[model samples]
Target: MERILMSLQYNGAAYQGFQIQHDLKTVQRELERITQRMHQQFVRIHPASRTDKGVHALEQFIHFDSHLTLPEDKWMHAFNSALPNDIVVTRVNKVDDQFHCRYDTIGKMYRYRVYTNPLRDPLKVNLMTHMPYDLNITDMQKAARLFEGTHDFTSFCSAKTEIDRKVRTIYLSKVIETTYGFDFVIVGDGFLYNMVRIIVNFLTDIAQGFREVDDVHKVIEARDRTKAHKTAPSEGLYLERTFYSEDELKHCVAELNTL
Candidate 1:
């Protein structure tokens, strides 16, 4: 038997989410179904992140152990041919049997897109959140900065989150201007449920003058989920990248700042 690692990208609009749901379509279900057909046996795929419905991924990783012997390139080709058009395997490699995608990840980067044009762009409807009016981006940028560093993000996560430890370390946080609107880029050691989307809503509230930039400090201190803004729509969130090493994460932060 050999363990294989795969890097992939998917548009989450078509599926319920990344995890397998026997009754509904999902990224994992689609991948595993095709894999099982190829191997003539059950193959369980473990993913690095379980992205929510309508939350896209530019880069995601998964691993599985299969007894069928095939070259990495051929494995990718076979899967891509059988998988749905929305999901594409970007790369594949042999990995140690012990390497699990979820457990091996050291950091992850998430980006949320906001569109400011009054006229909705049909192309961007699935990619971003459209707001009719302009926003105070300068204030939004300030609010984004406040999310950096270590903090107990109790107020910024979903109330449904079962995780006990809300404390997490944010290494990088910034609002980058885009042609359509702006993107909230955040890199962190780990995240609780709906963390990124909630933060985006908080920043959006600040940009709209509904809240002050200093309110972020207040919200963080409150440690109450009700103190945060409503969770932004999942359509605008993307899992940008996942890192396995400290150096790779540091390099990505430096590279993102330059761009």
Candidate 2:
């Protein structure tokens, strides 16, 4: 079997999540179905990250092993032709057998978009989170920066997460101004379940003057999930990119910081 790596993007509103569920539609199931049809055999794909339901991905990755020869140059177009309108493979590459889509990942960037106004934009309703009132963008920006180091993100993770290691390093965390509201961008070595959304709500709380700016530190130090507010909605979350090496992660984060 030959190992293949692929980069893809999708509007996840249609799927239950990235992983396959017996009675539910999912991203993994769709890709597997298409790949199986093309190869004339079932091909299992392993994703770099399993995104949540209703979350979109600007740059997602997956790898699979196939017995049939799939021309790297033609696979993207072939898959696109068969895939649903919301999903598309952007690129494909042949890789060593040892290269894994999930295990080789070193870092990831996720963005949460927010739109503010009393009236919701029907078009963006599936993409951005709508806030009825304006948020203090400056305070949100300031609060986001505090998450830029190693911390036990227990307070920021879902109580349902089973991972024992709660400490993770955040390479970059900031809120960028957008015409509507703003986007909360976070780049990190890794994340716990629901961490990004929880952090976003915490930032929103700070921006709305419900909590002190320094409460972020208290939340981290408390190491208690109850300290954090409810998790933000899934619609705003986007898996922007995945990194495999330190050099790539550093360069991309540096480039992102300048934006």
Model 1, span 1-259: residue lDDT tens: 9999999999999889998876888898998888789888888999999999899999899999988899999999999999888899999999998888999899999999888887989998788888777689999988898999999999999989998999999998999999988989999999999999999988888988999999999999999999994999999999999999899999999988886
Clashes of each: 0, 0
**Predicted candidate 2, C-alpha RMSD:** 1.2
Q: All candidates: CA RMSD in angstroms?
A: 1.1, 1.2
Model 2, position 51, has a per-residue lDDT of 93
TM value for model 2: 0.96
Per-candidate Cα lDDT values, in order, are 0.91, 0.91
Give candidate 2 regions above 4 Å deviation.
none
